[model samples]
Target: MAESEEELKNLLMKVKEESAKYGLKRNIKKTKIMATGPITSWQIEGDEMEAVRDFTFLGSMITADGDSSHEIKRRLLLGRRAMTCLDSILRSRDVTLPTKVCIVKAMAFPVVMYGSESWTIKKADRRRIYAFELWCWRRLLRIPWTARRSNASILKEISPECSLEGQIVKLRLQYFGHLMRREDSLEKTLMLGKMEGTRRRGRQRTRWLDSVFWVTSMSLTKLREVVEDRGAWRALVHGVTKSRTRLTTIFTIFKEDMSHILSIYLSANAFQHSVVPVQLVTHKQGFRVTLIEQEHEWGGTSACMEEHGLGIWDAHQNAYAVHRNTAWRDRSLTSWMCSCMPTPLVPPASAMCTEDWCGSP
Candidate 1:
């Protein structure tokens, strides 16, 4: 801006004169002026524009100090509102945990972290973001505030790689990569260009890329060189985006609403469970039953056992029994065929005829 009153008047006149050629006029009432140094009085054709300490552009808060703290706070507020908008689904007994998580990731998270790629996050901003993310998880999971569940445990259920911070890192890195690939664009030039200006009286403000060292493990100079190799840059991002803090298991689903589930088993170690239709295979050694064991949650494989007589069962879905005294080797043919059927159909011992069961099947 022009420092002297005469220069300011001439500069403002020139601006007005240029606009007159296009028949355009500045909206002085709508225009606003902001300055970092001492406030000054200026006039444009007897109209004065209002000065403001801060203003909003797009969704971001533009502060005179160029701090992103206000933007982060606003993001949190908007993000929280987005979560609250889905409160019904989030807290619904009918919605599964996975679905709720998807809702948050697909909808709420993006809204909250919008424009995060340009953020120069401070320690306080990091803390606020993390706390808000944790709160979202706790709320979605319906975990009580009084609960002492370790963050590790909660993070085990839902990966930390999927958190807000992780998302920002990914988005920023991806943006960097996109900028790297572009040709002769203003965005690319600005990103690569060094600022040339009078220095402020204190330490230099943090550049958005300053935090990216953790992901790239390289300074801006090296980043420019390395990012040219798209494959390597992608690999770096994949490696960084992978959850380093995951718990031992990532379950697709847990013991959820077991009212509709019967005869289910889980192995914590295996991170899998038995599904429907346990197999019944007939072996020469009498018969062998194949089904997942209902023991350790970590039960790794299907269990095989000798043909056991039916014990107790319900009429629907399945019937189960075990031959307590009969060794699999000692079991008779009649027991093998009758294992799945009722005792009445199986009948007593040696009277039954063996009619080529394999031929029938």
Candidate 2:
């Protein structure tokens, strides 16, 4: 609160005098000082106060540089410790997956996200946070690192409505809105005010508001206007969080599924003679698989299935039967159509297929 050492000394002397009148004493040994630029030695009543680069206050780390990276790392460590403490419950077969997820959300997530509302998250920090979240889920599922399971698979198994980052966004938006609504306060002043200073050179570091603006895709003026209406602000925050979660889910699915399909196509020695065009159609329910057969020098018939249908190979009939359900039964050549077939045929991969191509039970 003081601008200089002289001002701080005067302020400390006045505080000591006021405390003495109330029969109290300030502990100089416990007192610490941190400056934004450089550390300075300080002595109060012949006792030297400690100078530190960072310190914990109210369960949150306060650094001299005003960066939240250290605090985030600390939180991740705490989260890991919490997971370790609950390893028994998480690993128990008797404990349901839902119960384990609830426990993680209630216990582990809170520990990591304790004071995240004030975080000025960068791309690297966000990545670290998401990785930590995945780690927590993997541990809960008792999945070892050697398993090589995709993050999408894990997310699909758990089916979380919102990601940890999304939750942080929600908290940050709520806090920002709260601060904006206040008429006059120190927090509001500090958040909205800017100090008069010169440039520090090099690329500018991401600020807290900058992260907010990036997430919300709104300018300060427009954000302020929206914040005036509590309902609108809440809706905006919800939309942003929901969109982020949806996009993340979609991207993960696309990445993993595409890679899987490509690996299958490339590894198949049968498809070297023909050109197979695979198309991915996305719908609200899920993803639809489409295979288009193109004629080549060998001469073949073009086969295209209807929209929202999967082309499954019928090994018995040597034809393809279109399955309406998008759920993939397995990743085998017997289930999926062979690209080398001159006459492509799609069939259902399910065991309970009523169609004749699947054969009578």
lDDT (Cα atoms) of all candidates against the true structure: 0.59, 0.67
Model 1, stretches more than 4 Å misplaced? 1-26, 40-42, 195-203, 243-361
Cα RMSD to the true fold for all candidates: 20.1, 14.5
| Residue pair clashes in candidate 1 | 266-297, 267-297, 267-298, 268-297, 268-298, 309-321, 309-323, 310-321, 311-321
In candidate 2, how many clashes are counted?
Answer: 6
Q: lDDT, candidate 1, residue 201?
A: 97
- 28-72, model 1: which lDDT tens digit per residue? 777765667555544667787666767888978787777889899
TM-score of 2: 0.69
Write the residue-wise lDDT of candidate 2 on 287-313 in tens digits.
333443322221121221222222343
How far in Å is the alpha carbon of 327 misplaced in model 2? 32
**Runs in model 2 lying further than 4 Å from the true structure:** 246-361
